[model samples]
Target: MAKHYPPLPISIWRHPAHILAFGFGSGLSPKAPGTVGTLAAVPFVWLAMQYSLMPYLIILLVASLVGIYVCDKTARDLRVHDHPGIVWDEFVGYGITLIAAPDTSYALLLAFFWFRLFDIAKPWPIRVLDAKVHGGWGIMLDDIVAGMFAWVAVQLSYLLWQLF
Candidate 1:
């Protein structure tokens, strides 16, 4: 059976945290909000790519920290823990996936696929963390781990491509 969620309140637009936690409205999508939010992050990732890796990592770090607060706050306001509409974690996760990726469209696309796969599959420790944790930390940790898993996959793939 499909799980049902209550419709979001209009106040999501009026609050800065809500706006960001929702991924600038990308999370408002009625279907697959997480995927939409992740896709929405691609442009920002591209923009981050314009700078050196140091800057990109710093931005990713800040975003991850902020995401914990925003996601927790949004979920608390909604009286739901880790509501589906709260997708700031996805944004941070996708960012982590591409930290060392080449500045190419194909690399970005590949990273996206890998990140989504790990996120959705939630293998081993990712699944364990998702189930065991709670609050903002819980909301972000699983995706962060997913991003790390995807990062390894992406880096290995790139290395293999170079070797051939």
Candidate 2:
């Protein structure tokens, strides 16, 4: 079972693990840290886009894998199961959400909103996976699912727009 954790202290930021786990400081936002982290990730999408699809996908995979370690170590250090301030998952999730998405302002905006909604709402399997799973995968999978859900909505909207 996950132990209850108090809000993180300023001192926590000094550690390298915490720094990465906190979305490189975006997670430090006084409010809606996850949303902030996801938004902060938007600019980075272009960096991944510099590569072709396969390379971008590989980058996502590697980042996600690294996120598991970052999240796990940070949680263990804090003695918390999954801290709200640990928003590296949000960054990675948003990256996954925008993969293969059309590089349009509208698409990016829609993806940002959709990913935030699904991440916050935690619908269906997202909520289920969050609870049933444990450890780092547990923490990351929920956001990944949320990203997929958001990605689907964005893709469908693009397709529907083309038809109309």
Candidate 3:
């Protein structure tokens, strides 16, 4: 489905925040923008994993906070709230989803699939939060929760692999 994203012409790409909020242009994909944005985040997730866990956590914390502002400002600029093109939340969420798993490509792939499923399904409280939240939080909260679910799934998958 084509969301009411503003036309991403040269003018839209001119703004740094817009570019960031759009997942460095990955979010602009006409089909499955969220998926594309999450996929684009894998490299970042891997890069962040090069650091120790504490630093990675700190980095994500800062990124999440920054994402709120970027998402908010970009939405306002586009005159469309929670537009599909605004997928910084997906970047943050996907990164968060991989946190509990090993940094190997297999683990990252698991996180990616589980995160995408929970994100698309919007199970339980995810659906509830999406309905009630607004603005930047509205755009982010559901995906964060989905990331949490995916985290659990990723961790479990890791454990199961060890057990076998």
RMSD of 3: 1.7
Model 3 scores a C-alpha lDDT of: 0.85
Candidate lDDT scores, in order, read: 0.91, 0.83, 0.85
Candidate 1 structure lDDT:
0.91
**Predicted candidate 3 versus true structure: per-residue lDDT over 91-112, tens digit per residue:** 8888889775676889888989
**lDDT (Cα, tens digit) per residue for candidate 1, span 1-164:** 33688777557888898999999999999999989999999999899988898999999999999999988889888888778878899999999999878899998899999999999888999999988999899999999999999999999999999999
For lDDT, the strongest prediction is 1
In model 2, the worst 10-residue window by lDDT is 1-10
Q: Which candidate number would show the highest TM-score if scored against the true structure? A: 1
Cα shift from native, residue 24, model 2 (Å): 0.6
Candidate 2 lDDT tens digits, 11-120? 55688877888888988777778888888888877678678899989988988898888888887877777787788889788888888987777877988988999998
Model 1: CA > 4 A from native: none
Per-model TM-score, in order, reads 0.96, 0.91, 0.93
Q: Model 1 — TM-score against the truth?
A: 0.96
Ordering by lDDT: 1, 3, 2
Root-mean-square deviation of every model: 1.1, 2.6, 1.7
